[model samples]
Target: MSPRRSVADTLETRQRILERSLAIASAEGLEGLTIGRLADELGMSKAGLLGHFGTKEGLQLAVVDEAAAVFSREVPERVKQAPSGLRHLRAVCEAWVSYLEREVLPGGCFFTAATTEFDGRDGRVRDALAGMNALWRRDLRIHIRRAMSFGELPGDTDVDQLIYEIVGIMLALNHFLQLEHDAAAPARARKAIRRLLGG
Candidate 1:
């Protein structure tokens, strides 16, 4: 193969590995990932897999990054055209619930699974998950503050508290859908959000 063809092939292979890793991690948790298992599942040799990511930790980190990209594409990116303030906030939240309702990941929310899997741990993986979650919270805060400025929300609203409650709704929605398989979970979450926002 030409040099350009070789480089393209390498990129394609890496993408394949990351895609498989995301699916497996979503369903089984990042801790459940193993080089041997991935190699066997993908029909790639252990050496070849290792070549893509020198260590298991490296692979896990890459998977976390990929998961973040997927979340951005599915949630926030979907609402980019919505006007900021309460309208954007509502659009983003609805997109988030829809992402989970559609079962974008086989295990439901990838971050929820990762958070539960690594919340108690200390390492790069845990730190990466925390950082991603923090960024998400920050976006919510911006929208909440903007809504306040527009008088859509009470000026006295505690932004952090509101964010906490909103996040709670999503967490509960994930739990209900994943554990109890509740079909009404999404509607319940949307209703609760609307009530909280005083709509």
Candidate 2:
């Protein structure tokens, strides 16, 4: 029998299940995630697991939010730890590459999977993913603007264009890392970022 869980313990258990669910979704896509599979993975009863998620949509939404929170917490912290301007921009690029390479999601990057999974779908999941993408793009714009202010980048640089370029680099690097064993992509990305930032 499972040990008796206090109210707080139960909440913590639910959090763990949600985190694991995201990882599983990342690894196998959302279609492969189910309450029964999660219960088996966690060594709990299906009914008990269902009690936490209630529905598949509920579980999917929770995973999307969790993935966003994870990115917000990790990437900025790494960037902030670096010197401002060009160095910070480089650090942010490195942090992004490292995050994808780390395989925080078993399938790959959470956004990468989500965009492919729900991009054209009209519903809560698509909205959630879109919002997450918007937020990240905004954050990147802020950094790019700061870089400009510091004279580390061109004065006439378009934030949107820079963001698009950076996103493309990140996506390319992610796919290369996922398909090949080469670490060259990250270095290549750093070089590209340096060129754009005028390092």
Candidate 3:
């Protein structure tokens, strides 16, 4: 038998596998991720791949987890660098749109593709996606709440309704960029956001 691998080696291999899997899932959907294909792509045996992820669902879940990690670093963490309150909320919107515009993934955004893929399907996949979405929405709400606390926004502002509108606008931004191929979508999104938040 081959010599035993170190802990670091194992972690590296798993990270590599998840990175490749995320790319495939981003461009094509989790349905397109297959054991045989991943093994072939990685130049590893199917059995070897199975050693890392016992099931395809497990691999998909891992991919979703990594995607969220990437999104957190790229968007939320970056936005939080701004001073809290209305400025923070605006920063969040700008960073979010910039993340989409930067093409971090072939799918524009991993969650966007995953959401469309698993929206109607009930399973661990949908649950995982929903959890990420909740965190993201919660972040937005927190920033809005901060704005109210800082006196940047009126205390009477309807947080839920404001979140609904902002989220809808971001969805439209993704739709326009991906489906409509609208070059102006990002600019229009920022404009709409400023109008919504009265920036």
Find the candidate with the highest TM-score and give its number: 1
Among the numbered candidates, top lDDT falls to 1
Between prediction 1 and prediction 2, the one with superior TM-score is 1
lDDT of 3 by residue, 20-122 (tens): 9998898898889999999999999999898998999999999999999988888888866688899989988889899888878777778888899999999
The TM-score of predicted model 1 comes to 0.97
Candidates' lDDT values, in order?
Answer: 0.94, 0.81, 0.89
Q: What TM-score do all the candidates reach, one by one? A: 0.97, 0.89, 0.93
- lDDT minimum window of 10 residues, candidate 2: 1-10
**What TM-score quantifies how close candidate 3 is to the native fold?**
0.93
Q: What is the lDDT of residue 121 in candidate 1?
A: 94
For residues 40-122, what per-residue lDDT tens digits would candidate 2 score against the true structure? 89999988887887788888988898888887666777667787776777778778877877766666787887789888789
Rank all candidate structures by their TM-score, best first, as comma-separated numbers: 1, 3, 2
Which pairs in model 1 have colliding backbones?
Answer: none
